[model samples]
Target chain A: MPFHPACHSYEPVTIADRLFLDLRRAILEGELPAGKKISEPELASIYGVSRGSLREAISKLENCNLVTRRPNIGARIVNFSIDQLMEIYQIREAMEGMAARLAAKNMTEAELAHLKSLVARHKDSLLHTERPAKTDYSQDADVDFHFCIIQGSKNQRLLTMLCQDLYDLVRFYRMRLSPAFSSTAMQEHELIVQALERRDGEMAELLMRYHVRASRDRAKQRLESMSPEELGSHH
Target chain B: MPFHPACHSYEPVTIADRLFLDLRRAILEGELPAGKKISEPELASIYGVSRGSLREAISKLENCNLVTRRPNIGARIVNFSIDQLMEIYQIREAMEGMAARLAAKNMTEAELAHLKSLVARHKDSLLHTERPAKTDYSQDADVDFHFCIIQGSKNQRLLTMLCQDLYDLVRFYRMRLSPAFSSTAMQEHELIVQALERRDGEMAELLMRYHVRASRDRAKQRLESMSPEELGSHH
Candidate 1:
């Protein structure tokens, strides 16, 4: 999940907020499937919410670019095209690179140690397994590592744009490409953490940018290999 | 205006949409100074719209991050701090850099020529001026040059994110800082155009990135030069 630490509340969110969060996660994770039409009444029934609340929630989703709504045709999950996917990678490389640089300067000693531990844990899992490829470097762990650096940047605008505006659009590509980069990815992650540990902003930013660009290139290759129809529901 | 040709209307938008657009522009341009409170009834009467429509418009602005809404206090225009201003620059460098790289590959011959002409026009303005330092380097012209390259990227995601999601947040800082970089900025712009003409993606990306980063550093220095109170309403 894309973390928003500030969104935590002492008072609970409304029924509409809950519905929006659930619907957003489902759509972003592709469980709801891209390009699937939403019948408002049907979804209202499914979520056990009033149609009005669901409509409000859906409007928010549309604002977030998670949904595309037409007057008569209704709403569908957005499918990004391969070109758009590569564009996202380019932007990510820039933003995440800055995040790494800031994190190098801003992260506490404890956070650096935590990052190192996470990388070590992943490497340990790989070594102990007979088939390292089957060990499945967990996506959650990877996201956690990145999220920590992102949050550590302490730049609210950067954090919001990356986590809220851009993260979901890439979930599909990430799911498809994440597991494929294992051993090399581990070395990249560890080196990035080491740069932060040294508080070397330049190296940290360079490594992070390189990592994101590499991933983007790999994603480009994968998408080029696919037919447009198969990448469907890609907006 | 940050053009979104797709956001153009086949059918005219509702009253709420009109109000939202007007209010968003006013807030972003600093016409309605940041941290100024919004009174629903006051704005409703000012806009000659119903309270319901005004409220809807305010909610949309809140979603756009041009305004902040609190339960008891109502809404106020967003005021970004110097740190937040620098944060936005870091992002623009990353996104705009990639846009330049993509534009090198994607821009039509005609588009490249047009970009070159725009740069030539700016240079001519500098040479003919009585006081080159006081010559008005039109922000509109500057925006047009950048906007063309961004759109020429043909990466809809990058275009939308840069144009829609991020551009206006930096306007105040940009308007304040833009003049300082005029002559050299003209040189940088021309060099970038030359790279695009040569279809050199790497050089174009590098030059464009350096341009953005230089602007950012200048903006940062300006903000740092200001006293907290002088910066005013910086949140």
Candidate 2:
């Protein structure tokens, strides 16, 4: 029998698939630090892959906005300036606002319950840490909370755009976010969850938008406070 | 002197750049109809390009969701089902909604006046067309209207995502939009402009979101009314 590819199902993975994820993770975690010049030969050898495989990965990363390549010159990791990061936050406000609205109607009772618990846990942590700025919560946990709400939106396209397309860039931003940013974020999350429980989609969406904008302001202020000398591209 | 790549500016373009735009135009215009299998060799021959160049173009197209490649399975033009189209509308709602909000705040007096004339011209055409449904106004004008508002948002990242990344797909949807959809859209555009004139960002955003969602419903209802026997994959 002839093997016909399924209309909706994806085919098997290739080197480009794996390398794209690996390179993306490295960049997000600052392993391949921003503003660093990427030597294709070095990466190909380091990853134990061919130049062809590495180039493909580079192309995919470029598409994902994680890396940028110049003709004749070469590729470099994307360096987000303070302004660019704030622009990202503005986009996030719109995206997550819609996500919260959808989640209000789509989230299951059990999902709502888990979200409640997640916020409560964060609130407890906020209370316990006398100097909340000194206690660094797991970035993954923070990621999970936002991701959970996004998943609850049940919009596959939205999921792909947010959780997949913008994943690395958002991760990079959140990873560098100061611990002091958490308490307010936690409070906002609690209110968002409460609105979701009541199926108040409008309120939930508005609050989520406000939450993201507030976070952006905090991030911008923090970055601004850093003396120009210390806010180097590599760091 | 150290050769440093600019963080915000993109690097130079190559063959992939030209072909991606060419092929995208062909696809959105339905010259490369939806559900058509993409043969690299055929496309290469058609465009007088090498296989290597063609593949790069294909990769770019896939990234834009204009085409879908399934590893071992081949690539095909993205064939949107009604549900998928609705999903696209939801995403557009969020993005254009944010865009309208920002545009309301940022558009200069001259920009707002130009926008006024644009909608006025469309209204004139709409009134003149005999059946209106048969005349088919230029899709480029429609694109410019949205692109203008998106530009007014003045958010580079949002601009890239809307204009650069999701561009072709959005164009495809707009190109297929029935002319019957024009009258109401024109009227709504007028209202949105009025809101912008008043500098009511919130109302402008809401109207824009509603406009997009209303368009989606009309498209959905039209598609649904067609019989399953008419539901060819190509259609």
- On DockQ, the candidate that comes out on top is 2
lDDT of each: 0.76, 0.76
- For candidate 1, the share of real interface contacts preserved is 0.69
- How big an interface RMSD has model 2? 1.6
Give the best candidate by lDDT: 2
lDDT of 1 by residue, A5-83 (tens): 6433334257766787789878866678877888899999998989877877887787677887765568887776676
Model 2: per-residue Cα lDDT over A102-184, one tens digit each: 99999999988898888777777667867655445645556667778888888877776775456567777655555564666
Cα deviation at A160, candidate 1, in Å, is 1.0
TM-score of chain B of each: 0.87, 0.84
Runs in model 2 deviating more than 4 A are A1-13, A124-136, B1-13, B45-48, B133-135, B174-177, B228-235
Worst 10 residues of 1 chain A by lDDT: A3-12
What is the Å distance of residue A30 in model 2 from its true position?
1.6
